[model samples]
Target chain A: MKQVVVHPERCVGCMQCQVACAVAHSEAKQLVPAQFESPRPRPRIHVGAGPYNEGFPNRCRHCDPAPCLLACLPGAITRVAETATVMINVDTCINCASCAMACPFGVIRYHEDRSAQAGKTVAVKCDNCLARQREDGIPACVEACLSAALTFETLDAAYKRQTDAVARSVSAVAAAEALAPGWALLNAHKKARLELLTSPAPSDEKRAAGNAREDTHVRHD
Target chain B: MQYVIIGNGIAGVNAAEAIRRMDPNGRIVMIGDEAFPPYCRPMISMVLEGSVPLAKLPIRQASFYDDCKIEPILGNRVTELDVDAGRVDVNGKHVAYDKLLIASGADPRPIRAEGLELGNIVYMRTEAHVRRMLDALDGGARRALVLGGGLVGFKAAYGLMCRGLAVTMLIRSGYPLSMQVDAFAGGMILDTLTAHGLDVRVDIAAEVFEGKDTVEAARLSDGSRLDCDLVVIGKGVLPALDFVPRDRIEVDLGLVVDPFLQTSAPNVFAAGDAAESIDVARQARWVNAIWPEAAAQGKVAGINMAGRTVPYERSLSRNVIRIFDLDVMTAGVVDPQVITGAEVITRFDPATRHYRQLVFQEDRLVGMTLVNAIEQGGVLMALIQNRIPVAGRRERLLAPGFNYRALA
Candidate 1:
């Protein structure tokens, strides 16, 4: 599942990330004008209340299959093929706000005024500072973050983390077997028997964790 | 009230001009550290490149100051400023002021390395710098080594190249102008310099100078050495704030000024390189050391000093450069971290070695790096300056063909 992993414990609540976001959206490439001239700059990635009193920022979790991407009737949101980062197209946004409503994370916002040419409200959200990341090593928010709270990791990196977790599980099994070889064999047999007694589980994580021998037995049958 | 202005660079002259407009009858006294009049610091690169002559580099004629009824105090060093007395001592002579503006800009960072006091070693900042280098060049100096790859170093290298000297630029970073542009853009600049027969090295520092009186050669970190007759150290400048106290004023990388360009002391102001104004767009105080911003800021300082309550607000860090033929421009907060996601429009023809990149974070143009396509710089700058909300996906701005309707 593709998602953003936020550690609110790391957030200092500097709101430099917010200022960076506003600058990303602003025409002047800065946050100018009196505070009253514009709306309190809406940041797509918000530094929400700290989780577990950790005190950090939050944004779209990008659910397994993002509900916001699914709910967009105008097709303004698309995942980048290279990095799978979600990008929002301003022109295609009809201001239906269905995406905003569907976003479980509430990451999307519609502009108050439509761009002159598009004549339709534009949708704003984080694009991962794609250009800057491609040019520089880090994204603007991550670069500007004095606390070093935010980061961007590749999909391969996430896959590695899960796979490493699985390796640890396998190593744990090996350690249990070393302590009592005969007992370990008996436990494997007991696990195989339990699989036969219970109905096939649906959760993929559990299924991946299940004995491979059971699948072999089913295939033979 | 007599307004006494010290220093005569872009910042000082700009303040003088602004004060003349704000208080026509107010006796304005302008003191300059340099003998020459106000000129653009940004043009120093062009000056070294020989594109602009020394005479033409000045923004206004010396007569312009006299025409405005501003007394020009040239070649005088301001020894002290008595904050309590509201007076400045120039060459031990006291000049009283109802208000004092300190625009004494920074000097080139001194070279602490041994043999730096030699005849051929130079630091490019004023006309004397160019004249000194030219004097050596006239004396048949053949090889030149520039110590930094920033704007100053690059310009110095370019100028030396114009004089038919073999030029080499040494940088401690991986690429040139790494502080301003990205690696890709920096590489493009390197290509331009190399194409012009200039040797550029990154990740290398000037380890040692080999000569005694007039420097002869330089040894690099890689154990390689280059023969050099002239050395121009373009190391960055540190703000000259010796006259001001730390407690009375805030000092970050530059002096901390409020939106009004006022220091902590009342009736005391600062402008140009010395004052660190807030980059209004970023909502952060940063040193805007560029030329146009310095001029605009000096004007604002003057306006405020003349009893106009105009709080100077808008500050966008903008700079455009044409290295060889590559047009590079970046404005506002051009940090890599801000670009969360972006769409790029690129047109690269390998045969010509030309490249153009317009980086958009979502639909807005947050940062851009361009090479060869010099003309598009203005349009992208306009988008950044206008804060133009992009209409479509970022790809629209970066189409295969040029369509400037996005600018409109």
Candidate 2:
């Protein structure tokens, strides 16, 4: 059972996964055709700019004891036992954002979907690309990700690999393993630049005035 | 073990299911006032508004009791509960129990007025009441008069409005859902309802019903007579704990339950609308009678009843409502005046019509009211629930694009 794993540090917020996601869920299933499709397909995954302007990929964890499932008023949300995917029945969904309030990760979105009843809007979310998976394909988001930020692998395999890397990093005799050295360096540079620009004292009043709303807004593209 | 559970609501049903998972051989006898299978209680409002059919209310299948191997005593209310003797009297029969759960839920608080037995006047609490309202609608109900500023009354008024009826809501507060949300957020909700042509009368209530066999009009408290065909009272609900012996079992606003969801009496427990436990945000005794709380409490109660000492966590007061174009989510102590040292921050983006009002007691997020953009509400709610320190992160939460990463 391979599932999508998130590696936030490697993400550059290019939004290629968002484009690929919309195309994958669209009627024509292509980038150019998806734009012209009625009730345009939307991405289920979101990329949030972290506090220090680092890219952070956000999506549903498909929790075993999902809060959204329990808090659902119409009982529209359910879990697929095989894939461990939380699926929403759009027909039964009342367009009530109860699931959004229950979802701690803030993954679920409400919009008019093409697969749903014509013009009726409903709660839409990630289905783990079950249709694509059935055809022996990976999730659209993972396939579109160029930075290896999102990968498809078994949870145990991912955990074991991470554990081995962490153990080796702590060993005194062995050289530490930096998983994505280039990405790590890039993120550290961005964070340091952000810290320096915003931490100006009273003497730097001109810089402070320009950077007042610098940390206020960060678009989740 | 003979397990006697009261009420077939979500709480009782979840408790029964939990106990079945642990004790397969226990003789579970569930006594419920509602004869129908366990249905989502909150969806009764949807049923009222004609969005969801009455048939679609059941949360469980027809073979629920059979599958769980539990004996069900339906269409009966608990007449008396003898905690000392470990017995329950429902429909003139003493059903014994080794471990008892009082998940009897709550009933709509009755209002005092003339013509109390009027035919068309109803409380939108039970499925049967909604059925009665539907029948009235089918019988050519035109004008509706709703009382109360609470969720029930507000929902009833909204439901009637959705059905293309002329609705006049009489609220005894500054705005609707006053208890659930703050004044500013309440005003936003009130605006949406009004924009949809819902006639709202603030600080007003119905004094008397004037009609022959069915309600035709209501005499207002402000000395005004209004024409109405149906009357729905949503003045809120009281705990259905009349049967409990207060002398033996401690009772507050609801039945007082311990951390393990057990009552003061041994071998007895209470959950759902009837259980009063410590409130996480308020940090005091409070009854969060919502469905999700009931489900969580019942699971814990059943687990503890099955011989595992699983302590139930402090309950949070929360509600999320999607009314018209507005989505409102509120939790905990929303009223700032109630808390002496509480600091309140409100940010309204008029362009998008999104609002965020957060109440804080020192570094902890005590309560929150969100309008429109509320996808990340659960994150803020978790912060409040866990009593996490939000020293410099308060402004970040008020931002419209706030998400889980914002907290990090």
Candidate 3:
């Protein structure tokens, strides 16, 4: 199944995805009119300013054996196997922050949502855009992402593409045949500027090991 | 392989499900005192508050045991345990098992007060107890007196007020939720409750109760008499490990368990409120009896019992309470004043009505208490639980708009 895969390196700190998400979930599926809707349709996807002042889009992973699902107080959270989506029953939710305490990624938010009964507040998070998928439309965030930071693809296909990029980046004709060369160069410059400003070496060291965008820059020194 | 699990709580239920997933052909026997379908224990307070209906409590159906193909024994607690023989005696029945799980959760800690054997006085712990309280409430319980300022007491007080009952709460501590939140946060919660019609008495205990059949009044420690018809005890809980032979098994406040959730006895394991695991934040053996911990511990324990070696690590004490207009979340050591070299950073935005208190041991976040704007509490708590060092300007964590990008 095609799911929204985030490529953070490709993000240019543009919050267009946030605007698109709010509109998609709004009673009126348009930007200008969604602003006027009661309760003001909020975006499920949150884009934060990254460590290097880049864009880091944060959304629910829809983790199997989801921590939020298990930590739910009223048993309001459940896993829908078809979309691999973890959903919250707004009616059953007691508005207790039990799910908030258990969510390690801090993706869940609480507020008065349109789906909640009688303007009641509920715990809200990414639902994999199941409503859009049902209508044969891709997720609004992916559609609005002009930079291709967000894409709709299967996990296997994403892994295959990333794996190929890693192989090609280290090859004999590496620089000319790099994957997303513009994005790779942009993040590299951000990292360099950040290193000169900060004194600590440990966070950078940990980031170097965990970051996948560093495939092009293998600095042994 | 034969598996026997004690208690029908989340811990035991999850363990049974875990064991069945690994060893599908294993003979599983589940013994529980509550005959009702496996329900969410934490939502009992919601039921008391009248926010959640009684039907919404059960997490599973009546056919859960049959669906799992397990033997079910209900309405009975284990009378005794023969650890050496690997048998549990309940209602004169000897249930033998190769693998044993003591997931019997905690019970409400009893208090000593006169006229204890009266009607209308109850403890808010089990669904049955909550049902009894509901019966009193349905019986037109107008004036209610509550003891203790802990989670149980606070919830009961909140529930009664919602039901239009005049509630007078007595707390042994300076403020409510003393165990869960710090002085500042506790005061905020107390003020909210007070505004919502909760008559609170601090540093006081019920010395004596005077009533005919049902409790009518209580003499407090401060030499004052309080008149009330309904009474609820919100004192905290202690582990329900009565059947275990402490001489053979190493027992602290709760049953001592290894990283694998296995007890000292052969083929015996424990989880949930009954087991004490190492606290990731405090770096000590502590029983985090919350529902989330119990659920996590059960899965780990079941996997280990099913022959897979899964270590149960990173047990942290955490709680999030939603009071009227306030969302308070706390984790690990919120009170770090006594700890040497503890650096505390706090911020309160009067404009946004958000408050954040971050306690640090060096660069690593040891504890935190978030008042409002607590959406990112889990991210902050993960740093504490994993002992991850904070890299950026630490003050950024106290910001109302803090997110994962700040750490990047």
Candidate 4:
């Protein structure tokens, strides 16, 4: 399943993606009419400015072991098995905010809309534009990215691109070494790069080992 | 290999699932005292409040046991555990096991007062208790008196109030939820309860019950008698370890288990409220009776029982509850007296009923309490669990826009 992946380096902080998300979620599905619609539509994504004028768009990652689904007392939240998209049933939700508190990303919002069940507030979060995906095969946020910062792709494709970028950087350095007139040094560097590229990627066991080391100071009873 | 599990609560069910994942063909037998299938115990209050139907209580469908190939023996109590013989006596039948797990859970503490054995007194622990309370309400029992100001007591009081019954709560502590929250948060809870027409009296106790056959009134420690038709005892619960022999296993407030959830007896394990494991924050062996910890411990125990070695990490104390429109959450060691060199930061707005307090030991966050605005609860718990150093970020910890991902 493909998801909208945000690239912080290319984000220009225009918030057009957010606006498009709100419009896509609205009853009218249009920008001008959605502003005056009853119970104003809320954008599922948020763009925040960071240090040194860097901006990033933050939304739900749709975690595999989603905490929001676990924390929901009434069992209103569910995950689509085929797409792995986390969603909430608004009609069954009691608006208790347990999911809001459980979400680590702070993307879930508790919003009050008069048009929804006579002014009852409910938790709202990104559903990855489920309706649009079924129709257009892409999320509204990724479709609206002006700088092409967001890409809708599968996990395998994303990781492959990242590895390819790393390989390109290593090859570029090797070519630069070859131009410096040191054949032996360049060959040694090429051999090392080949071994690095051929070796299997890091696994969760390595991550767990690092975690155990970091937790040495913790007093275990 | 055959695995025998006692109790059908969340912990036991989770253990069964974990065991099935590892050893697919193991003969599994589960015994539970309750007649019904496993349900979410924490939602008992919601069940009492009539917000949720009883049909939706089961955590899994009836086909789950069949799919998992588990033989369930419900509505039967285990009478004895013969550890030496590798069997448990249930209703005069000896059930043998290669490995045994005790997840019997806990039972509500009985109210000990004169005339306490009256007919109308209800102890909220199981589904039967909730049914009896609902029946009493149906039979036109109007007024109720709840003893204890803790979580169970308040939930019972609130449930009774929702059922159109006049409720009067008496607490022995200075405020409600003394063990979980600070005085400020407790005071706000008291205010909320009082505003909602609940007669919440703190720093008081019910000394005696006056009645002919059923409870008609309760005499207070302050020498005052209040008329009541029903008495609901929500004083909390104690670990149910009476079925185990004292000489066979080590027992503290609960059954003592090691980091691997193994008891003194060979091939025997315990989890849930019945097992006393390590408390990470206090560095002590104690029964932290909460749902999340119990489920995690059950998983760890099940994995180990299936020939895989896994250590059960100690869990910090945590709770999230909503009382009549107010949201409150607590995590880690909230008591000021527990930690040495503790620094406290607090923000309270009585008008909006929003309160936030963070407790720090040196530079690490040890505890936190949030009311109304609690989106930071998961982040706070992660910080406490990871022992993140918050040296100069104390203010950021309390900030409304605190980003938890930044810590990574």
Candidate 5:
């Protein structure tokens, strides 16, 4: 099944994902207007600054083995048949706070008294803007990320990349301190901004580099 | 049988059309309290910027009613409803109906403070509200004290900003839209508003509206006074259910309705800002006062009223607005400390003032907030709704200009 995989090493944590998700659900059907109209503009995803989390934009992993799906009492959360992504059915959500309570990552939130459904509160969490994809073929958050930090992937490939990302993060901390002293010591917010300017560029393979060189015109003096 | 619908707003207009589509043989009569034709309620703010003329706000043409063979009685309101006898009193005349719809949408909450009813003071709901606001603008109302920082409050503030009026939003809450978005996003929004040169103060309630014959100023709860030529009260709308029996049908933000948009009483239907429809996401029955929800609910209510037995699907309590050229959108619940285990990820570009965040549990996306960079709003929205798995490509999902087909 496809799922969201984050490369925190590549993350500048620009927060485009959250705005994109909110806009995806916005009434104005666009971002700028949605931001203005949203009172408590429920953002499904959250971008936080912490020593433990660093610059990664957090979202549901959509596990092959799901915990939240099993915990939901009213069966509000479900796995889409096509994408194997876990989704919430607003119709089925009872807002019992069961699945929300059981969530290990604290993804599900109870939209208590502000909704139209009685005894049924909206659970605020990321469905990955699936509605947009079904119609437009691209998720809002995924398309909006500028640092190439957030991405979509299957389980096996994600695990490998995540493992590699952790490794890179560990080394990058050292490299970052060396390249720019006192940078690694900076807090999450400062680090995120610095990462925006200093993060390593996407590695180019040999074939791509060869293609780029061929495209470059030579100036003979 | 004659069917009477109250209100010429989105809900009432759509209800008329829905009734025509269902019960073509039945006589459809629409009663509106406003003089203007049915218009998009959300577009009212656009009028402040002169982006749309007062005449263009109507959702449909004048011939719409004529084509549908519907009789629309404008500039009249039904103050009394005789549900037992199935009749409504409008302009001293009783209109009979076999099935009556109480689509009398809520009016903007009026400021009870003294001197608030002056020519300058206005509630931004109808065309008249806009007309008064424009007149005041022409009268050189240099400053505006907007009461309440809710959707309407913010919209008015933005509109006033567009009009080059020094605007200050006074809210009783700790922050603007504290109930809808998280503190971080809210802070970002506050910053955006502040950056636009509007003064926004939260946790300071309006104790009283102080002015002479006309609105001149407002006194705050924090012992501060705001001097302005205009004052707007946008404390939200209360359902216009004065005619209905209080004990028979319960009302809490609005008229309580079942999943099918049916009222507590059998054969009686309710929709629009007046009815409490189910919030499919939050799974609670609360009154959603937005335009799209009202229109969609009205259509569903009409279909079901015609013996179609169609179920009303609650939409995600969604709102989107524009501040200058910046795009901002929010969805789902955003209460603080509500999320315990969910991993929060934020991407902020202070230089560009762009922010995007996604909240996830395990691997699935459940909520999001977007600001500035909103073109990909559809993509992330789909992922949240579809809960698309981001396992391998979670990193790619955050990449700028990622291939669309790859995600699919």
Candidate 6:
């Protein structure tokens, strides 16, 4: 399936991706015209400050077992089997924000649309630009990224790119090892780092452990 | 292999899907007592409110059964389970199976009040119940007396109110949703419901239903009578396990199942509201009757039945409901009675109708209740599931801007 991969290091924090996303979802589908629309177009992607000063655009990961999909009472949010894109049907949404609350990533946003529900609000989230993709195009965010920070590619291609990068790094390390006999420890560390970077990210176990602690601390008032 | 699943609800249907994925050529037979195809039960209230039509009730499309290649025997009830014989009697006909799953779900606990036998006394359980209630409402039934202040009861009352009926909710306890939320949150919910023109009476019980052929009035335990044309009994549900013999398969409030959802009987398994699985919060065996848990349990049972070794992960009790335009959610060990030795950090903004309470035992979050503001619920549940220690981060949990990544 095609997914938008984020390159935070390459991001300049321009926020053009957010603007483009909003415009893409707007009725006019243009920057200047969308701003004058009845209900202001809301961006599905959010450009937020990241750790280490590299700003990243956070959006829906479209998790297989999406919590938003499970929490939706109106059955508005659904995953299309063909595209594997999690889409929300705004017509059926009750604007309950159940999906918003259930999203662990806090990517789903509530947009007040006067056109839809007489100024009533509804849940909105990234659909991976499914409409544009049908025309063999990428998401608006990817298209708008001036720094090439976002790229839409298949999962296999993404993994291959990462593996190729790691292979090149390992080869560079091997060249260095030929010159220095004391680079064994550095090679092991590099391999470990590559493994961590390449593998599918696991759910944060440490944070979960912190939240599940069953001890008491006397509060100092 | 012949895989027979009783009750084509979420659990049975998901199990069938999972079984097909595992064993390609397995013969899957899904039996349901309901005439309609498997539908989302939670949306029944929306249907009653006229927000969602009955046509949109089915969870999957009409071609889903055919695509899955599973035989569906709808409107046929399973009468007996012959564990030793490896077969079940469905409406008197015995159907053999290599493995069996009992996901018959649950039925509304019968109200034993005096006037329950009268007409217009309804229990919200099946599509038929919604149809009956709708029919009565269409026949100009205006006043509604809804007994039980729980989730089902509240939904019934709210739905009735939406249909232009005057709804009066009678709660046996001191507050509504006492099982899910605390007294404080329940009071807020009551206020919201009342603001929407609902008559909520707490610390009250129906002494008797009084009428000639139909319920005309409900006599309260507090010496008051409520005149009503319709009565909706949302008094909770019990596991529908009458088909299985108690001696053959161990049964408590529900059928007892192992971690793999395997019952005491060989080749027989159980899932959904019908099975008493482990409560992940309490680390004890109990039935968490929520839909997600049912789906998870069903998937686990299906995989194991298909010769795949996968243990069922115990699920925490979690529920999200919209009551009178307010969103209320509770998860994990939120019941105050059982959540002893836990420190509670609460933040309530009555002005905004946003209330958040986090329950922590030592440094770990064990339970949480969010009213109006519930965006952090999924994060909280993940923390509970992962057993994350939040030692000094209790305050962050109730914060509106709290992010799970920050904890990481």
Q: Compose the digit string of candidate 4's lDDT tens values, residues B213-290.
A: 888999988999999988899898899877899898999998899989999999999999999987766667878887
Go through the candidates in order and give the clash count of each: 28, 0, 1, 0, 140, 19
Model 4 chain B, TM?
Answer: 0.95
Candidate 5, CAPRI quality class derived from DockQ: incorrect
Q: What is the lDDT of residue B336 in candidate 5?
A: 21
> Per-residue lDDT tens digits of candidate 1, residues B313-340?
6565655565545656555544455445
The 10 consecutive residues of candidate 4 chain A with the worst lDDT sum are A210-219
- What CA RMSD would candidate 5 show? 16.9
DockQ of 5: 0.02
Which regions of candidate 5 fall more than 4 Å away from where they truly are?
A1-221, B336-343, B360-366, B379-408
Q: After superposition, how far is residue B398 of candidate 5 from its true place, in Å?
A: 5.4
Q: Which has the greatest DockQ?
A: 2
Error of 3 at B319 (Å): 0.6
- TM-score of every model? 0.61, 0.95, 0.93, 0.86, 0.62, 0.85
Alpha-carbon local distance difference test for all models: 0.65, 0.86, 0.86, 0.78, 0.66, 0.79
Instruction: After the best TM-score superposition of candidate 6, give how far the Cα of residue A137 lies from its true spot, in angstroms.
Output: 3.8
Per-residue lDDT tens digits for candidate 5, residues B135-160, read 88888899998888887888899889
Quote the true-contact fraction of every model. Answer: 0.00, 0.48, 0.52, 0.14, 0.00, 0.20
Q: Give Cα distance to truth, residue B254, candidate 3, Å.
A: 0.4
Return the TM-score for candidate 1, rounded to 2 decimals.
0.61
Clashing pairs in 2: none
Q: Write the per-residue lDDT of candidate 6 for residues B46-133, one digit (tens) a residue.
A: 8999878988788777887888999888887899988889998887788999999999999998876676888888999888899999
Local error of candidate 6 at residue B282 (angstroms): 2.2
Which candidate would rank higher by DockQ, 1 or 2? 2
| Model 1, position A74: C-alpha lDDT score | 41
Question: In candidate 2, how many Å is residue B374 off?
Answer: 1.7
Question: Where does candidate 5 chain A have its weakest 10-residue lDDT segment?
Answer: A206-215
Q: lDDT tens digits, residues A1-221, model 4?
A: 78778776566668998999899889899999999987898888887543222346778888887878766766678999888899887766766666765676777777764335757677778888888888865899998997767899998898987776666667877555433244334435544654455457654222222112222222111
Candidate 1 deviant stretches above 4 angstroms: A1-221, B222-224, B338-354, B357-364, B386-388, B399-408
